[model samples]
Target: MFPFFFDPTMMLLIPALLLAMWAQMRVKSVFARYSNVGSRHGTTAASVARALLDRFGLRDVPVNRVSGNLTDHYDPRDRTLSLSDTVYGSSSIAAIGVAAHEVGHAIQDKLDYSPLRIRNAIVPVVGIGSSMAFPLFFIGILFRGQMLMDLGILLFLGVILFHVVTLPVEFDASSRALRVLADTGMLSSDEITGAGAVLRAASWTYVAATVMAFAQLIRLLFLRGMFGSRD
Candidate 1:
């Protein structure tokens, strides 16, 4: 059996894994802290989202409550905004922040944001790539097939590219959310600070994910000894 812990590739991945773990913890901690603090206006998350969408001339976009924690999203395909149950009705700063962030995606879609359009166009390919990457790579290794291994690496790179694209999309959404919230008077300056903290913490998770994916890709290259030769 391969001793993964002692592997140099694995050793190099440790920092990225630790950073991802820390980012996850930070998002949860910050979100939880602000989730318990009610909004100054005592407005529910759904109301805030609806109001923002309307302000942006997106009255056609409907907000719906769905079950789950932090599962809020704006589905561009259906032109619907879905908020998790906790966020939909909660009159909390965290809830409002999350809701607004999702609305930012709707705005992005409405405006045809270039990164978002590219990201959406590649979703299916990324899904297929992610599903096939592991099996193809493992089989190629077992059979010592260089072509198959190269194809597997190519597919995995698509997955990595997806993560890379996601960074800008998420960051832009958070930026739009904070700015809109402030401009619309949905949150006071101090409250916007707390919301910004939550959004920033959430953004770190995407950064960590991208870093981890890149590290994993590098580890794979190292494991295959692809860096040693000019093919």
Candidate 2:
């Protein structure tokens, strides 16, 4: 039953998984190195964020610390920038770099970035679709229900669309991070390059996830087309 599920086309999906794993591993490695290496630039996360916000004239946004490694992000909902404990207090280049990336999201939100707006608009639908799509597809197969399979396909499409839109939002955030870091002198030239490597590795994880989502959608489509009941 699962043989076709693991065919040559499925093998193609391996790279995406590897890429995602590689990205996560790279983040971990960087964190390990910087966990003890204080930022050579001598700036605290709060001060760095405050300086950047001041530059952008966004002084009202609050920056706070949240628990978790590399779990930093800027919430547009309550206008808060949440940083993980390590990133919020640590002075490593990696810490500062990640913090800036989250700040980049805040900047995008402030300017109403188009990709971010689209992503936010679809979040609810994608959330529902992702949760139910695969199970529905499998149930449709078991019962040979064409309606169920089609419904699964529609929901699966939402997940894919979210992944597609996510690519740009992520890339844009990294772009913003690099520019800000360079302009503000948060990192030395070598440090900037290292941060770039880290960001690129992180971006590939999203790429991998998108590929996996697309592959699952295609697999479902094929299964439905070939074996779906006519009734």
Candidate 3:
């Protein structure tokens, strides 16, 4: 019998859940609004991305078109930049902001940014920890095994650390994207404002995710009797 089926500890997740919802809605609204506003310079997203990458001395990084909206990313592992369907050919402010953000990651990788390097290094271990955390915790609860629960808490700790580290990486990337856009004259002052707004709105999603991860960890700890008393 699972005692936590009706556990009150789950109440701790409500604030983060609400924040996550609001962040999703806010980003989507902002992105859609700016996506309709085309760049005055009339440059394709891929061309802009390539130009930025080359300017940053990353000529070797290939920019590729990919399907799906907002699927854009820079893969440090392969040194490739992928632009999503919504951004690959568009000349909109939203598209350019997205392209530049991914490029920011490439720049980070090129410079060997410490946080990013640490994040990339932990990816493998975090994968294992995330996959096992919940299952191990539930098994521990079912058997009243203290060590198993403690191990679960520890494994989940890696996931929490990942979320925390991601916050600064993302914020720094946005800052780089905005600054580069302004410096290269890729976007005018007003256009830069628009792109900055899009990036700023999108950042809340990561904030929400980090908050949710922390809340989950707290809930796990409470269940383990590390803090609050269990009924």
- What is the lDDT for 93 in model 3? 96
- At residue 10, candidate 3 shows an lDDT of 91
lDDT of 1 by residue, 1-231 (tens): 465334666777899999999999999999999999999999999999999999999999999989998888999889999999889999999999999999999999999998899899889989989899867866776677766777888899999989989999999999999999999999999999999999999999999999998898887788677422324
Locate the minimum summed-lDDT window of 10 residues in model 3.
222-231
TM-score of each: 0.94, 0.89, 0.96
Judged by lDDT relative to the true structure, which candidate is superior, 1 or 2? 1
Clashing pairs in 3: none
Clashes of each: 0, 1, 0
* Candidate 2: C-alpha RMSD after superposition: 2.5
**Please, what's the RMSD in Å of model 1?**
2.4
Residue 47, model 3, lDDT? 92
lDDT of 2 by residue, 23-124 (tens): 778777766775555667778776787678778878999888898877788877788888888878777777777777888888999999998999889999
Top TM-score model: 3
Q: Which stretches of model 3 miss by more than 4 angstroms?
A: 1-4, 226-231
- Candidate 3: tens digits of C-alpha lDDT, residues 62-180: 99999997889888999999999999999999999999999999999999998899888889879989999989987887778777888888999999889888988899999999999
Clashing pairs in 1: none
